[model samples]
Target: MLFVNLPVSDLARSTAFYEALGLSKNPQFSDETASCMVLSDTIFVMLLTHAKWRTFTSRPIAPATTSEVMLALSCESRAAVDAMVDAAATFGGTADVNPAQDLGFMFNRHLADPDGHVWEAMWMDMSGGGASA
Candidate 1:
């Protein structure tokens, strides 16, 4: 199972933002300090409040302006990639943080959540056996 733990300034707001992007909150593993957002059967995102996060690590939290990591997810279609980016923007995320990439068989767009975590929504056509440069 994949769990991406993220530090958020506001738990409720971050939970809502992720939900807007189509992930459902898994109440089974959620509490006042953190929320488990399920993206797929094996993919989960744990939104942790700054205070709760400190319990797991003593390192200073990276500010939103810093690019710590870029998380990527595959989409069913090119349209789905566009839709996700649009939804992110409508729900407090910044759209097109990076230039969109279109490699004929693949397409992707980068977006940033309210907390500045970057995500790349991508779609790829694998029937051709390999991706083109």
Candidate 2:
């Protein structure tokens, strides 16, 4: 299983943003300070409030004002990549930091959550010959 922990300024807002992206919340590992968004059986995103996240480490938390990481997720289709970007924009997220890419057999877009974390939504085709991603 894979778990990506993100420090968020507001747990509620972050959770809502992720939910809008179509990830379901798993109440099993949620609390007032943190919530779990399940992307798949083996993939999870742990959204933690700044305060709650501090408990896990002595190092200073990376401010949401900058790009600390660029998380990438795969989409089922090229259209799905665009749909996810649209949903993200509708839910207070922004997809303007980078331009969209189309490599014939692959497509990708970048979106930033309210807290400035960037996510790349991608779709690829490996069935036959096509331009590289």
Report the number of the highest-TM-score candidate: 1
Clash-forming residue pairs, model 1: none
Candidate 1 C-alpha error for residue 113, in Å: 0.7
lDDT of each: 0.96, 0.89
| Steric clash pairs (candidate 2) | none
- The worst-scoring run of ten residues by lDDT in candidate 2 lies at 124-133
lDDT of 2 by residue, 55-105 (tens): 998788766567888999999998899899999999988975688888889
Query: What does candidate 1's lDDT look like per residue over 1-133, in tens digits?
Result: 9999999999999999999999999999999999999999999999999999999999999999999999999999999999999999999999999999998888999999999999999998879845553
* Model 1: lowest-lDDT 10 consecutive positions: 124-133
lDDT of 2: 0.89
Q: Of the candidates shown, which would achieve the greatest lDDT relative to the real structure? A: 1
